[model samples]
Target: MRILVTGGAGFIGSHLTDAFLSRGDEVAVLDDLSTGRPGRLDPRVAVHQVSVTDAAALAAVVDAVRPELICHLAAQIDVRASVEDPAADARTNVIGTINVLEAARAGGARVLFASTGGALYGMDAAIPSAEDQFPEPEAPYGTAKYCAEQYIGLANRLHGTAHSVLRLGNVYGPRQDPAGEAGVVAIFCGKVSRGEQPVIYGDGGQTRDYVHVGDVADAFLAAADAPRPGVWNIGTGAETSILTLADVIGQVSGRPVEPGFGPARPGELRRSALDVTRAAGELGWKAATSLEEGVASVYAWVLAGEPDR
Candidate 1:
């Protein structure tokens, strides 16, 4: 199969590109190099330095590649940044997704969108939120993702296409940028390596479903192989709190971490997890890496000078 991965030089996208290539599939990458580094990608893969927001360039690349499947992972992923400038976030997350879908239609390609499970649900949502729950996003980032999913659904209905959406949990693993607002695991690992105390915001009790990058790649593979279009939550179906995560990191690093407490950030979710039962049943996919094991990988990667590959 020929596959095209948007934002393929970034953390999760690079890992997913590896998964597809290992299986003997042809892969190409489309990235703008804003936050994505070319060094993260394989030398053999042809990378088009194009942003998804640029419709003409993106369409030209899509038409040239003519991929059978497109894994759309490009987006403005910062929550705080989205709060500051929603139009910019919408231009990338919302309008950018529309461009991908439109380009996919022209090339007769199927799309697999990387949606957000952590940000999609509201503060009052169930512990393990299901796919059927109403999305009450607190920030523009999440709202933009949900709005993009709507376009995907509309395309499927109007064109009778089988594009799928994967509502991803808080993904973290090697190659993740520690400076990013998200990817708490990577940030914590970096701080631990530097002997800097990890800061806890809002009592350190807020929780999230931190899925590993490798497992997330497997979920994409499973979704690609499936013969239908649908929404699936890719997560561990369990919640891990910030304080507990720090404990796990400490254990992994073989050091006792005394975290510094600070005032909680406003508009943050207190608890969040995804009910991945549907993905397990339909896509036959489940997160296999334990939090301790994943955190250890990130720590090792950070210690290794944070190599892109």
Candidate 2:
């Protein structure tokens, strides 16, 4: 199948692109290199240096590629940035999504949206949040993603556009931008590598469901193969505290460093985890990699200087 992956140069999208290409699918990657690095994108995959906000460019690419499937992953993913400037977040996550959907609809392509599991569901409602739970997004980023999800659903209903919304947990692995707000694993690992004590916010007890990027990529692959449209939570259904995550990172990197407590950021979820039972039943998807394994892979990659061709 021919597929187009927006933000395919970024961490999660790159992994997904690799997965699709490895499965013998022709792939085209559209990325503006805002947060996505150029080196991370595979040379074999067709590359288009364009932002999703540019509807004309996106539409042209979609028309040329005429992809049977479109994996929309490009967005302003920083939650803090969203809080600072919500309009920017909406322009990217919401408007950019509409552009993708419009281009896909014009080109007769199906879409697979990368929605946030934690952001959409906010704090833990039922220990591990399920898809059916009401989403009370505390931040602008979550609100934008949720809004986009609704647009995707509407597009499916009205335009006959098929889409799968993968409400993802905290996905961490190699190639993740350490500077970004979402990349706690990379940020912690980088700090620990430099022999600096990692800073923990709000008593270091805030918990998140850390799913591996590879596992998240596999879920997208499964979504590509699955029939019909649906929303599914992609996570391990387990919560790991930030304190424990720091310890695990130190252990994995073989670097001993203390954690310093800092005041927690506002609008941040205290605890977030997802129940992946629906994904398992519908898409036969599961979070296969452990946090230890995922962190170790990231640490090793960072130690090796993040090489790509």
User: Which candidate should be chosen as best, given TM-score against the real structure?
Assistant: 1
Clashing pairs in 1: 202-264
lDDT of 1 by residue, 149-210 (tens): 99999999999999999999999999998877778899999998999998888888899999
lDDT of 2 at 157: 89
C-alpha RMSD by candidate, in order: 0.8, 1.1
Q: Taking the tens digit of each residue's C-alpha lDDT, what string does model 2 give over 1-309?
A: 999999998888999999998899999999998877768767888889999999999999999989999999998888888999999999999999999999998989999999998888866477799999999998999999999999999998898877879999999988886656678899898878777877888898889999999999999999999988999999999999998998898788777758888899987899999999999999999999988999998888877876652
Least accurate 10 contiguous residues by lDDT in model 1: 262-271
Local distance difference test, per candidate?
A: 0.94, 0.90
